[model samples]
Target: MRKIYITLMLVVGFSAVGIAQEINWLTLEEAVKLQKKNPKKIMMDMYTNWCGPCKMLDKNTFQNKDVADYVNKYFYAVKFNAEGNDVVNFNGKTYTNPNYNPAKANNRNSGHELARYFSVRSYPTIIYLAEDGSLLAPVIGYQTPQQLELYLKLFKNNDHAAFKTQQDFQAYAQAFKPEFKN
Candidate 1:
């Protein structure tokens, strides 16, 4: 009877842990539409199915509880497939993957038109956008949770706008303290 009680408690504990680790991901259009009522920055995760680092970014950083909770609170998260065939509309323009080959759906394919529009050159690029949907910057490559916190807080708090020079940005970086845990 005691073993059954302990097993039930373990299940409840694991279920609660799972609930806190999810970032509410939305489509680009959905996030933009929602911004009208509730203005929040957008953090777009641009990835491809074939990219190894993209998968790592998901399993390691995005899944981290601190990253998920902070993103859910301050930004709209977007998961966009850089090479997938999806028709996306943004900034009064419609974009599609005209060169998408279904045969290469799970392999290397041409870049989507939206990915090209944003000038995303590599996989696992986290593109930060303003609350009104304007582009801020692209953080390229895989970053751990603590490494990503710098950009997240800077953009969320509008701290990046204070930089008038490279040295200013360097100074900000030199004094920056990351709050996210590894």
Candidate 2:
């Protein structure tokens, strides 16, 4: 009975060791700082409090175990409030939401200068950055786990550079098979 109990506990502990239920999200600055020593792509979720799709993305897509695990392995995840009043420093520049209204924190607030710098006009945008903290691209709106796997693989592998035309991307998208569970 003692051996059985010890074996069971060991199995459970080992299985849980590599599985990720939640993403370890960091600030953009933190991610960038870590990138200097350990280079990995940064995936930023640009969201606002008022955006319904942003909430859904958090609940449905980001909550998936496979998505969380993949992100934790290949990228440094940053959850940034696109309309919040957080001061940010990036690429030798400082950014802030100078027009942010405290009363409208839950409603429509002023856009952050960082969001403007990234040209994020929509909520729930997934902004991908290179390992060196350079901008890769922005995937706008909500995405399911399976749907998001394509972009995750595309940027992680730097395959987006091969697409020289819209038709090229369309062809690639058509042939792509998602391995992530929904």
Candidate 3:
């Protein structure tokens, strides 16, 4: 009976550990506040409900254990609905989707003012921000785990500061060796 109980405990503990290995997502406000307490870059997934590629990104890349673990360790992850009615306050200004129609919420709707602020014209745009909440860059499209790993590592290590021209970024992309499996 003692041996059986010990085995059961070990199984439960390992299962819990597996289940706990997920991205710790925070609200925009929460992420900004946490940045003040402990400095870390912020990664915001600006997506709409009707976007198929956005859904694929959530399922295929964001759900990957290696991607989630790396993102959680280096950045404060935020999932923002670009067309939703969430009011966001950043950089001493408030942003809202004043023209957001509830009936068209799931379909194409006017995006939030903050989305316009970042000039996100497409879905599945991953916006990277500085530790102080300033915009860094917006990577548009559905990026696989291997593809995003490059950008994650670049920003985390502050390698983006060295880019003087578009050619520089292209060279970095060409030389990047992806460490994550798709």
Q: What CA root-mean-square deviation does each model show from the true structure? A: 2.3, 4.4, 3.6
User: What does candidate 2's lDDT look like per residue over 1-182, in tens digits?
Assistant: 99999999988996976443799999999999999999999999999999999999998889889999999999999999999999899988999999999999999999999999999999989999998788999999999998899999999999999999989889988999999986
Query: Compared with the true structure, what per-residue lDDT tens digits does model 1 show for residues 1-182?
Result: 99999999999998876744889999999999999999999999999999999999999999899999999999999999999999999989999999899999999999999999999999989999998788999999999998899889989999999999989878988899988876
Of 1 and 3, the candidate ranking higher by TM-score: 1
Location of the lowest summed lDDT over 10 successive residues in candidate 1:
14-23
Q: Lowest summed lDDT over 10 consecutive residues: which window, candidate 2?
A: 14-23
Candidate 1: deviation at residue 117, Å?
A: 0.6
- TM-scores of the models, in the given order? 0.91, 0.88, 0.88
Q: What is the lDDT of candidate 2?
A: 0.93
lDDT of 3 by residue, 1-182 (tens): 99999999999998886643478988899999999999999999999999999999988899888899899999999999999999988888999999999999789999899999999999999999999888999999999999999999999999999999999999999999998866
